[model samples]
Target: MTDLDPFTDLLDYPMYVVTAQADTERAGCLVGFASQCSIQPARFMVWLSKANRTCRVAERADRLAVHLLRRDQGRLARLFGAETGDRTDKFTDAPWHPGPGGSPILDEVPAWFVGRVEKRIDGGDHVGFLLAPETARNLTGSRTPLLTLHDTHDITPGHPAN
Candidate 1:
């Protein structure tokens, strides 16, 4: 195991479903590498795996949508985390609508945001998309329980890590 694994494996990370649209093509995937990076200007970042189809589409996209699923939405998490867009139409099975910049906003999520892609950073096996929030929604007035890495241990990623 890598040195980082010892510390990293002890923590559970929140998961998100990130979607991107470029031209007529749409793609999305379950991501664990995301967080708010700024407050004054309000910026968030999501890291897309280089091996996933979502990264390809996100590369050409002007915006992206990030969705937070409830604790009970394990089925939706499995759909995005274990399924590959290369051979599967994930949107066909889920409910969604077009948001700002034509990003797909999953209808089942409790909280979400559409962000303009401000920059892309190449970080090893993942590409980090830095976003400036354009719009955000919180369907639940209170904090909702979220799905996390600890809850998705059984899902085998649809693509290679590298």
Candidate 2:
């Protein structure tokens, strides 16, 4: 696995913020492991770390909101990435609205989607959440570039490592 680290580190992928709400609890966190797994049926998967507060909320959430930040939105990224939800109310620190299934939709994101959680797959320290988009909004035009993992390399994880 150590040998693969060098290869994986060379890949520059987009980063995202995934939000979930279950009952009265709401949580969100920065995620780098997400991708469109299918094209025909339009399926997307986002991996949440087992140690993240968002993962706990997402376990019981019926739907989740996925947000794409602009390249310049590093502040928004850090808010979710560098601060733990356990001690901080991330929703209060940012502007958002209750989206479908009660997921918080961050107002500053360039694009976002509310998806129904169809399946959950355990993958080592992270769990892959398979989502089917119920609704999507592109706040910015297609020309807007998104933030990538390379752009957020300096951020430290808000959640403690397990």
Candidate 3:
């Protein structure tokens, strides 16, 4: 194994809670590895660990909804970020609606986007879901501090190696 802990240096990266749905089954997880990959096509990529319950649901998902949560929503982040969807219904406690491919769009989020999964690449432990921005909208709110990797460093991963 590598001696360096990549996570130790991830403090500066932004974090987000990403949600997806396939029919009646829905799931969400707090993700740290996501970013824009293309400038011309505006493609964004979200890496889901193979062990995550959300990854199971995402296999059949046609679209995914990504959200940016504010710092005040740490509890919300914990619900999705610190808890495994395999044992908990994270959506039951939040407000959501169906979006592209029947994916759930959380209303409590500060901003959201519905993207079509154009390609999925197997990247060893995690798979990258490349999304083409189908639609995006910003919620009305004052500029608020976003939840960051540093803010969640103390919390254990919702889905650890299994």
Error of 3 at 140 (Å): 2.9
lDDT of each: 0.95, 0.92, 0.85
Highest lDDT against the true fold, candidate? 1
Ranking by lDDT: 1, 2, 3
Clashing residue pairs in candidate 3 are none
Query: Which wins on TM-score, candidate 1 or candidate 2?
Result: 1
What is residue 44's positional error in candidate 3, in angstroms? 0.1
lDDT of 3: 0.85
Alpha-carbon runs more than 4 Å astray in model 3: 1-11
lDDT by residue for model 1 (40-122), tens? 99999999999999999999999999999898999999899999999999999999999998999999899999999999999
Residue 119 accuracy (lDDT) in model 1? 100
Over the stretch 1-162, how does candidate 2's per-residue lDDT look in tens digits? 577888998898999999999999999999999999998799999999998889999999999999999999999999999999999998888899998878899998989999999999999999999999999999777768789999998988887644
Q: Candidates 1 and 3: which is better by TM-score?
A: 1
Could you report the Cα RMSD, in angstroms, for every candidate shown?
0.8, 1.2, 2.0
Candidate 3 per-residue lDDT, tens place, 14-130, comes to 788888888788999998889999999799999999999888888889998889888788888888877998889998898888877677888888888989999999999998899
